[model samples]
Target chain A: MERKYWEEEIETMPRRQLEKLQVERLRKTVEIAMGSKFYAPIFRERGITPESINSVEDIKRFPFTTKNDLRSTYPFGIASVPLQKVIRLHSSSGTTGNPTVILHTRRDIDEWADAMARSMYATGLRDTDIIQNTSGYGMFTGGLGIQYAAERLGAMTVPAAAGNSLRQFKFIQDFGTTALHCIPSYATRLAAVFKEQGVDPRDTTVRIMIIGAEPHSEAQRQRIEELWGCKAYNNFGMSEMCGPGVAIECQEQNGMHIWEDNYIVEILDPVTLEPVPEGELGELVLTTLNREAMPLFRYRTRDLTRILPGECPCGRTHRRLQRFQGRSDDMMIVKGVNIFPIQIEKILMQFPELASDFLITLETVGDNDEMTVQVELAKATDDFQLLDNLRREIARRLKDEILLTPKVQLVGKGVIPQSDGKAVRVKDLRQNH
Target chain B: MKTIKQLSIFLENRQGSLKRILSALSDQNIEIQAASVADTNDYGILRLITSNQTKAAALLSDIGVLVNVNEVLAISIEDNVAAFSATISSLTDNGVVINYLYTFSKDGRLVLIVRPADMEKAELVASAQGFQLIQGWE
Candidate 1:
């Protein structure tokens, strides 16, 4: 059967017209961005203005905005609109430091809903399909952000939030939920739970699985599809822009198509901060073209992936991003929880018996991604009780910091392969995401 | 109250890894007194008592292997069913938690290797039970 789009004309818009629209929106975004208390002074000092960006290429002239910039502008410092105009705010887990906050007005939320509606539609989710959003709701954008989009698409949405696997299964079977949105790792875990109950995933009415908010491999996507006997589509988005509707894979199952009208996508060498060659893997940089509350300019996403250099079979002119290869930074996504290497290092530094010569290993044991931290016992450390107790305490500290449990193993002094040069800290041996 | 030094070597679960570790020590003419491998899906801990643990660990480290030396309680008891039963009862009665226990035949002697949660309690129980306790065996 031929595929249908929710917004066919925009999805397959001509390249010339798409670029013109991007330039127009880019200029508008710059003007709105200047209203931000965070950017207004920068614009004045740097001699940057809306008139300065005559075309999309001129966007590069305006200095790049990094995650550090957002961190420094914590709270609503970066908001262009007044506090009264902002309707909602979502923040990332900031246990180690200040969390990145995203502010949105009513119009921004509606626009995000439209983008998410298209995201769901491209993956074969229609208004007739019942959607169960399993992403975390509160501070996380994945939960409520997509809920609005599904409702905007006229789909009966169940804001089931996260966890409660038994109730999740009941809602799926009882409501005949057709669209499933969640992290691939949790989906894998839930699939195993259902298997234990002797439930055949094919018997369920789930037809379209939108897996995103965490990077996963194509093999993982296929595994999820085989388990549920349904199509698993990949989506790409971050809280800095909107939510999970920035891009999504069509039924073609090629790469994720990022909407050009809402955001300008760029792949740049993280070190040099220059654009990479076509189809070359580099750090993904994005600019929010239509964000009224907080219009971001050249915000570095740190996600490393190449652009699939071709048109999609589903006929969406928007360029597609290849499967996430790895991150430019040392951000580790453990079971859908984002973790930084420094966080682990910082925790390890506090323990004296541990010499901090440790390696973080990511491996897939069955359907679950397990993080194992192999640390070295200090040379003079001979107290077995202290070592065992310290291991448990370190695990508790890590769980408190990252909100995920990790296997803490005490290895030999030289077991982790340290050297005079810069040592590799992470070893990812998992099949995919 | 003497203690036995047991070598705990970390081995990634793969074919011939155990054989490689065993052969590596044997190649050096180092004899493994008593050996056992506790395995998981990814890795294994090969625990062995050797007369030359310091040399064995040094040799393994030289060959880029990971090994640790831990002091454990090794007891020599009569090669009988009641001997093993009494051995456990002695420790459990004294509130000693047995982390793990394995036995092997060496020189016609039935030796029970025990790693306890409480080292002090284990040593005390073994002393009072009249079982000949060897610090660590070759």
Candidate 2:
């Protein structure tokens, strides 16, 4: 075996020592945060300084940074370092408002690559492995993020940017690719193409699959695995947290190991804004502990997930995060009931008759708010009773999960619009009078 | 037992949904021999027998329509109240309950398309009563 750990000393650091490092970095982060124009005034108003942070728990003392805060600041508003020092920047698509920009210095970029390389290494990817990145480039972080990491890990990289499945397969075969990085939906779509081409994925050169960027249920992961004949690892990251490499699943394939050395993770009830019990689902809050150019303080990811209670057998002291349930921001309040799209996805995936594509639309009817779920059938059926039973079962299960019965619509395959990037699962047209 | 192919389409209960499927099939020169719609507030199931069942289905599928092709029993009945009643009563007397049925004319002759609870038995009963059966698209 060619060494188990990438940075063995740090990866296997004791819990007590990891906490000490977190506190030390937390203090440094506060000092660096003071340099930013966005946080300078807030810190000064509260009399918060580097000396104020004594432990990791002190992260709560700082105000929670929401997406709105990042929006109001706009481009270059949150940079702790000058523009000359920053070498690169990645931003989230702001369809409703200003897109949040994350500035990265040369050192910050190198650290990001290091974090990603460490993540890939944990998954047993080596220098000899040929990595194919299918994520979109340019504005999307998943592109360059994985590219740099694969190169950093000394692996051969094929930057075959998203779409053009024909070209993707060509590259995979030509380059003898061993691993693929893509979103969960794209993975399912590629599997369909594999079937159409009469080429079994197991017979192909690829063996490892890394999927992230979109929220997916455990059932979806299992379906991908079965289709690809390989292990589909769950990955978690956001553009605000420097894209992917923030957390990844090791060979154990249980939960994602968050890079505690680079981040301080906290799970809190989204509504109450208070810390929830460990191993319980709550909105994941992340604080960038190592980034130099733009370190975020208590950034509310709005993603709902729980921390696994036990230590991973992989021996990495970094805590594991259960696969995300859904984003808190994606929660829809219809008729006094809270429903998340992932909840609907989980129920739909249980049925082999339903395709992975689905859309949830909330509309206003007179004085009542109604929800309709449109899902595509995996395969056409000649029996009306089978379809009727599937639709009724979906509605019944949804009612139990969401406490509201949504009108379930079974659509034809390929009816739902497919986005090359993150999929839009919900459309709320409810007009509040 | 002889049977004809019938297309069961899932159509959303909204304006132009039916028109979209109809136009798509017509554009491909596929004729609708008989049609019946079972509808609810949300959506409808459009049962159609076409001149070219295979061609019509492929065309509808290309335009993103959910279609299910099923074999149904189509019997030619005389153009008279007594003949229609006697033909239907024969099947009922033989313990065959028609789940669904629709009618259309072929060369001035009445054709009754039926999906019964038991298709194999219904086809036998119709044939034993000396009724002419329309099998396949032709």
Give the top-scoring candidate (TM-score).
Answer: 2
Model 2, A236-300: lDDT tens digits are 77888898999999999999999999999999977678998888778999999998889998899
lDDT of each: 0.83, 0.87
Interface C-alpha root-mean-square deviation of candidate 1: 5.4
Best by lDDT: 2
Model 2 clash tally, residue pairs: 0
Query: Which parts of model 1 are misplaced by more than 4 Å?
Result: A1-3, A331-433, B1-138
Query: Relative to the unseen true structure, what is the Cα RMSD of model 2?
Result: 8.6
lDDT tens readout by residue for model 1, A47-113: 8877776677877777789889888889888999898999998889888689989999999999999
User: DockQ for all models, in order?
Assistant: 0.06, 0.25
Who wins the DockQ comparison? Answer: 2
Classify candidate 1 by CAPRI docking class.
Answer: incorrect
Interface RMSD of each: 5.4, 2.5
Candidate 2 CAPRI assessment class: acceptable
